[model samples]
Target: MSHTLLNESNADQYRTRVTLLGTAGGPPWWDGSDRTGISTVISVNDDHYIVDLGEGWGPQFRKSNLGPVGFQKGLDNVRAVFVTHHHSDHIVDLPNLLLLAWHNGSDGLKSPIQIYGPGNRGELPPIFAPENREQLPEVFNPDSPTPGLTESAAKLMEAYALDINDRMRDNAKQDLRDVFEFHDIELPGTTGDRPNEDPTPEMEPFEVYRDENVRVTAILVDHRPIFPAFAFRFETADGSVVVSGDTGVCENIVKISADADMLLHECIDMDWVDTLMGPNSPKPDANLMQHMLAAHTSIEQVGPQAQAARVKSLVLTHLVPGNTPAEKWQQAAAGYDGDFYVGEDLMQFGIGAPRG
Candidate 1:
């Protein structure tokens, strides 16, 4: 199948399109709906950029129906990928996305798929004391550093070296190095400051990627102790859209999304989560609940944040209780009536278009 290449001359023919590829929060599972994990494909004409390659996103992308090319050819059309954080559910299919795209020969696939994300947190705080536990694990050590996106990608590539070698040996022209590129996001800083720390007290959005079709900016959000989770804004001539990549009620997202054409934000139904972790369940108690509150935004909070951001439309995605009926999430937009959408897998929204 012949793939259409997106370039400046024909850019006007296509309007920006945002597709909710996988709208589930925790992990990939079948719960009546086909929701996989949090993945969104933001396409400016034929240039497809994916944000958050969640678990099963590779398969989800194959079925997304974004480009003219069908099935595996569609995967090869992916221009770049942006990860919000290192959460397993968010990035479990990284290898699959990389490998499939590389192996499948699509036109204009020469440029390496650039993966951009936040750098590492220096060290992890001790989870448990040595004396308190029967067997102290290395993961609990305070001095051990959490790998950043770039480091993690390198490690993943290393783990898949044998498969990559075998494939390369079969086809001498196919090189893994030509298929992937990783970039670690860092804030401008002075001599003593950390590389990813903001230069000023007020955290602001910074440019992460730019191409013929769109300009992408990322702002640091408080998914705290998760250190640097980000919210991304993608702007094109048609309109601007913001994706809140797994965050709490974050001011950075509101700032980045100000007057955006649409805001795709994650929403959690805490009440439903609590019911799932009832007294008899094997789930962790108050601590887990506290973390949930700190890391994820409740449905009640979604409307207020969307209102504050003054976005044209609000689409709730990454549903925490993925199985909940759409009506159960409607009350989330009780006040500040704007265009509200209950995100479902494969749902497509056009940028700058009136809400349907």
Candidate 2:
């Protein structure tokens, strides 16, 4: 569909509309007008909330035509950003989004853009320490010592300090420091522990953020070894929309999405993936396959879960084989009875109503 076709008629209805910014899983690799990284914009009334700012999201957002002409003015419409996890594919565009949005201010942005996500994992013991007797310290070292989202954002800001200073001094003349408010989603007894090994203790869904227009609640999903990955549900006066950031077939998402107006869930076609990593090809390492199967939801799992959730409509996104033929997706949805769509970049859905 043409970007120009996404008119503001639904926005005028005072209902929520979700636009698929990018639907490709993993990274941007396909050749023929294929999907970008996974990103989705959920607009409630006039306020816009972004879920997962994957790679290429900036260009995709512009293509959606939801913002104004100028760069800053266009991004100024985004009220908050919710990240499901810290995976590079899911958050690669964060720095770009933060810089551009801050540079382009809008009258509506009275406060910094709120960013919510999981806290960091516990630091691994130093190499050569007693804990390293059984394992090679250098090989098992932690990715970084950062404790959580708050520190991660601070570090990102620190990395761009010089550029930020230069821009404020010579161009925008605004302190970019005031442009973002970061929050780490923490659960009891989870701090200072390895996320995958010490998952958040099972708890009921809880509010992550709220404003005049919408309320977002989060449920911990089983993306094992990644630790504390989440699926969020946004509720407004018009309807509720749920986003399954990335996960295996977890009941948490099903519970959170129960009776939701729309469910946007991630899906993988493992068979297709295996074909890509062909039989003659060296098999993926056992550990890698374990992580892939444990972390991602298969296509067969989607329909049954959505059926169990009783969602009014289902949109499958973050596709594993992003270039899979449309007919294959139909087969994937064989058990789902309600409205179903194989999402595409720039495809828009109006909540509380049918897919547009």
Q: What is the C-alpha lDDT profile of model 1 across 173-260, one tens digit per residue?
A: 4677777788988754432133234311246688999999899998877665565678899998778889998888767788999988
Candidate 1 root-mean-square deviation in Å = 5.6
Cα error of candidate 1 at position 209, Å: 0.8
lDDT: which candidate is best?
Answer: 2
TM-score to true structure, per model: 0.85, 0.86
- TM-score, model 1 to reference: 0.85
Model 1 score (lDDT): 0.75
Model 1 bad stretches (over 4 Å):
1-14, 28-30, 68-71, 125-137, 140-144, 190-201, 277-284, 353-356
- Tens-digit per-residue lDDT, 219-306, candidate 2: 8887765656889999986688899988887778888999988889998877766754545446544445555777788878889989
Provide backbone clash counts, one per model. 0, 2
**Candidate 2 TM-score, true structure as reference:** 0.86
Query: Which stretches of candidate 2 lie above 4 Å from their native place?
Result: 1-14, 69-73, 106-108, 123-146, 188-194, 198-201, 276-281, 284-290, 353-356
Show the lowest summed lDDT stretch of 10 residues, model 2: 1-10
